[model samples]
Target: MAREGQESPLLKVEGLAISHGDVPITLPLEIVVERGETIAIVGESGSGKSLTARAIVGILPPGINAKGAVTLDGVPLMRLAERELRTIRGSRVSMLMQDPFTMLNPLMRSGDHIDEMLRDRPEFASRAVRADEVKRRLAEVGIVDEDVARRMPFQLSGGMCQRVALAAALARDPELLIADEPSTALDVTTQAEIIKLLRRIQRERNMAVILITHNLRLAFSTCQRIYVLYAGSMLEVGDAAAVERQPFHPYTLGLLLSEPPVDIRVPRLVAIRGSVPRAADVIDSCGFADRCEWAKQICRAGKPSLAARDASRFTACIRQDEIQGELDALRSATLSATPETPRRGGTAGALVHVDALVKTFAGRRGRPICAIRDVSLHIMAGESVGLVGESGSGKTTIGRCLVGLETPTDGDIRINGIAAADFGAMAKADRDRVRRTIQMIFQDPYSTLNPKHSVGQALREALGASAGAPSPAPQERIASLLAEVGLSAAYATRRPASLSGGERQRVAIARALAVKPAILVCDEPVSALDVSVQAQVLNLFRRLQVEHELSYLFITHDLAVVRQIAERIYVLYLGEIVEEGPTERVISNPQHPYTRRLIESIVRSAIQRAP
Candidate 1:
């Protein structure tokens, strides 16, 4: 831990450059971490935030070459050999990786990993002391049980695994902690718990923290200062509160506008059009010039240097002053850009109906766990219905059951005037009809998409049996599907792993549309997406629903998202529908206590505190 009243900053990074062969990933970056202060390196995906962290920790990939001067308390980390770096890794400085599930050892028990982190410390010399410390750390992070400690990473929920990862990282009491997208995959409430725990632990230990995330909300919630990165370059840096009020850079402002707000009447989110430029595609001009609406000839001719804008604030935009002057006017234009009104569900007959759906899974010791208990809901033709609750409240289960992924213990599911159970039992030709009209879009696109299959191949597989006699041919079908989901036809040959998260999700949506489903069952579709991408995907979903006249059974834990997309909402608690009403009525005046708590859990991106 950093000593209180120590003179110099906890860490310093200067003249940092990272490159893979001739391609530059990051250019001449500079950052300073004061003792016990939290700083956020915020950006969208592919902004080189993780690459910066990897360079600091001396784990740059084999093909990558890093040229930087990174010092921790006057000691140069770049000069250190591998063995020396390893010694300093967990003791003086440590890293908590982005995906906790992948970072943790699936073979080892949770407590074992925590104990191993402190194995080299003299303070934890004995086994008994180490065991006690393990329990204490686990409890500190809200995983307070001997049984929990013994469980493997696969046995724990995403939230619990994240807590275990945190416990392990703090085990050695490192002076600097680098958390890379710490709570990315967790739900809102679990994310809140992790956020509070991180703040408390940082205060208790007086340790400096470097939080790397694409999440602006999480960044504002924790960091004292924010450095916004764009396409491997630092675009803006300022006090969190100051930047929140007035962002100097157009990219930063666009990012803020892209955020999904809890309270706003904006027609649609202001998306920064175009994708993140690849490192190899670097040009002499500003990296964001192509996407920025205010870009002029000068912005497209030369790169801007990081210059002072105001007190303790700097931005790398040549027209920062001009943009700052018209912030309100530009924002008003974005908010005033009207979206096509979502056609509400008229007094039409129900297209998909569920009556007292009950699903029970085999539990420990032969006890049945009721995942769905008398939960009843319906989606009208050309309408959208949402099911929202906490992570384990059976939202996904209900979705799976409705789409025929899971067999309900007892219930009546009617889709397009036909009994869903009977359709499942129908002959081959009849079963194909159900599959073509009622499709499911899963939560994790990475896992749902086949790694071995190209985008075209994945689409062709989905179109099987349904595309009888191949009216459009597989290639034509693939091209049309890609275009429908806002991707270029050239993306057909690209593999899932090569695509960005948003692009992969678009592919997932395309695959679902291959069979031309009339109703979509989307499970937590945008929960794990970056805010900007979430806005884009949400907007895309709205457009697709309108074009296809699609009915939706959207299951998610995000109240804000559901409020925007769903016409009617059902709040699930312990596998039961605790509250049901129109989206506006439920959000404005939530009736049930559980439903109110869920609504309250909707965290705002920015929080203002007393100066």
Candidate 2:
């Protein structure tokens, strides 16, 4: 509420509901952003976090219907026409998306992207003026190299592309900036840098920002307030520090526990029991009732309204007062619990060993560039080994080499005491037998999964391709495979497009297990998943490893994630193994400066908050 003559909020959303056709995507929600304030809208995929951001910017996809009163600077945006909204966009509000590469034009130079945003402005009237502004904008984002202006999007790294994207968004000096998962795709160090830069720019410009992300750590580190959404409804809204310290909703608590703490190791991440409900599956009752441990019979009675818990906090839970003590106890118990020490020495001989591995690619101007240089590591049978590095640091390349996706330029890869190259010279059956011992799981399961094929069909194909004798009942085998990865038989009937991100990854895992592989090369498998979903997947990996006698070359950029799953850690920097030791030692006492930076980059939301 504004005073009688005072101006309205810089951005105000009231009773906002979004739907596609007859199915509701998000329930009526409210948000208020004052000038120079930062607020986060946090939730898993399909929880309508991104949809809310899109709605606020008047850029919802076709067939999506948004009903609400959205005002910017006292102007009714929802009532405005497309032409009218176009003028307001970039000038009043700008959006920075998750994938900077997707937003940027690959054919155009970085400077041209910024120039287009400033071309219509009176200040940048001439080409020379616009060019100078472009350089200034790029420099503001930490890209000071003048040559970056001429470089195409493909020429720059992921972090550089993100910086350029931010430059274009800030080109118009919008009063409000909506950054939706802006740092999710980058590495830890790059992610921290981008967020720091965004915060600095926001304060310098006195701009209000709506930071939409699934990461509670990121939200708490960068935002002043957090709004937790579950199954399209806002469950909790409070100060970022207050929410991190004590969540009012069970869903918020689950999210906090789901994140692997860098400072303390827990036995297992407390994953939510089930995946988030789809818009069509959402009912009138509490959306989190199925997964909430404290859910009571009355929780399923009807939808709860967001009620004030305190002067600065709001929660949708009806039993907040009754459950506060228990929730706090659980939180304390989970965080301060005995550390799960890495069990070292209970594994068979090395299953996969790479000695003097070197992989080179043809660089620009026909120059040779080494991707993996003298990298040596071994994964013991039934042991999980982590390969941690930033983007372009040969983490994925090594995973690819281990899975036979790429051949080493100059090195020897021995699998089960036999050279990988020698397997090709052996009999066809022997070669096939050795090949089936290693399987790879990619980051984006959708790209690897066949959209046209059902989960059952994909698993069946993998089963048939293996050299082993045919199963007595292929259907039973497929079901068993699905069960191993925490999916039910019914999931077999669903296509990749119909499943959630976590479910699809489960299907991918089932398919990999279909070959009865001894080693699984997991490459950033849970990087993009929500914290709860990532926890579920990581736990599944640990369970499957013991049950099936599997070894993993877990490749990821996140030390926190790797700490939860890996027994040994190898830190890779610029295609070289800079540090290698036990997971606990590497994390606690990093020998390399690069390794220390990676650990420091982790956003420890459980222990820290925004100042």
Candidate 3:
């Protein structure tokens, strides 16, 4: 940490206010970051975490209003002209966005994009020197191969793309780095590697960093200080350890309580009730008052200013004193809920059985690249089976094959004793019946949903297909589906874009359940959601499995999530099942090296968290 009176802060913001269209999103806020310090802005979707980062980059979308003074090294950033800010953007301050695939130019070669940044500099007169520098930067981020750098953006995996983007951000050696959910989409091992890389770079460069994310564990592990944002307001600010040990605000407590336990026998996940309030609904009142269990009459009537709770902690809650006891109780409950014993039973009932599954894709050079080779596994009915792997490990390819979206090169997939190959060549009626027996939930809900259609239309379309026609009153079914997924009925008429990420995901779940399928192939379903929303979705999956006797082929990179729900787990590596056993046994006492690495990564992440 920087001394208080040593020098002026590296970055400072005061009286920051922002709006989207006609609604104010972020209220007047104050924050600062000193050289060699990292600050994490933690919040759920629509909490103004990403918006704040965008505001600093001067890349906020149109119809957004910002009023604040953002200064860097004593120079006012908001006062600078557009051209001036452009000069400072890549050379002085750089941002690493959430999704690297969308951030990178798809048409450009990966190496050329980094070289382009160097070519723009007047000092880089030699092409060979720039090329060497690009390779060195890529190597610095753990990507040492020459072939990866030469490949196009689309040719790389999501993890590889993220590393390329990080290299691009470091091409200019910016003084400040803004990483926004940098590891959200990555597997546990990849996420650990990225976090380690960022920390190493920051230490070596002594660059100030602003880490924005909804994952409290990630933030606490990487950042020294954390700021909790709720409904556009800064609810609390303090040292990460202090905040985690003794959260001062209701919202902060809610966030901490919402994380799912790593232990399998832990029953009853902690959930924060209600959704985040919209910007238009925010007023001069406690942002979390609506969902706060300890909210009082004063909490809803007036806003609370940040008050010093300790030497290093501050909170914006009128009932902080009264809530501390309840927060402590919740924390105790959370700790007690983690069980010492592991779950039993694995590889039974044969809900989904595959043999010699194979899928090959054409590489850039037109050579056949085997994605999955001779992969086989069995998932039991009413059982949760986890598919674990890093990117390019073919977990998703097998998932796609099981869902009938892609044809396997050679293999057999049996769901409920029905072979996938036989089901594929079956008549249209038989195929439709097989499809109705199994449904898939994709990773990107926003892309999966039709933008032009309302929730009702999407649900009705899916159910109508299974029902063979539209029901007499589809509205009630839509409402019931929403309720089944822990969403409000009022959301039935809303468009996909109009809903939060959690809400949109709930709608996706509802669409999958509309067919009354006995099996669900979830591909990273909760990876895009925050920890709170993730817990809710995990519990929902568990409940639906119990109620409907549904079997889940859950494919995810997050082992913590897998531990919570999966009865059995299959560890995939480079298109093969290297290890298979009960979830607890596979995760806790792994025999394969890859499985051991994954377990080590998860333990490292958890242990590195501020205590």
Angstrom error of the Cα, residue 443, model 3: value is 1.2
The reply for model 3, stretches above 4 Å from the true place, is 1-3, 120-122, 338-349, 364-366, 467-473, 603-611
Question: How large is the C-alpha RMSD of every model relative to the true structure?
Answer: 3.0, 2.0, 2.7
TM-score of each: 0.94, 0.97, 0.93
Give the winner by lDDT.
2
Please report, as a residue range, the 10-residue window in candidate 1 with the lowest summed lDDT: 602-611
Better of 1 and 3 by lDDT: 1
Local lDDT at 160 for model 3: 88
In model 2, pairs of residues that clash are none
Error of 3 at 460 (Å): 2.4
Rank by lDDT (best first): 2, 1, 3
Candidate 3 accuracy as lDDT: 0.83
Give residue 601's lDDT in candidate 3 (0 to 100): 75
Q: How does residue 610 of candidate 1 score in lDDT? A: 16
lDDT of 1 by residue, 560-610 (tens): 788668888899988989999888788779889987777666656552111
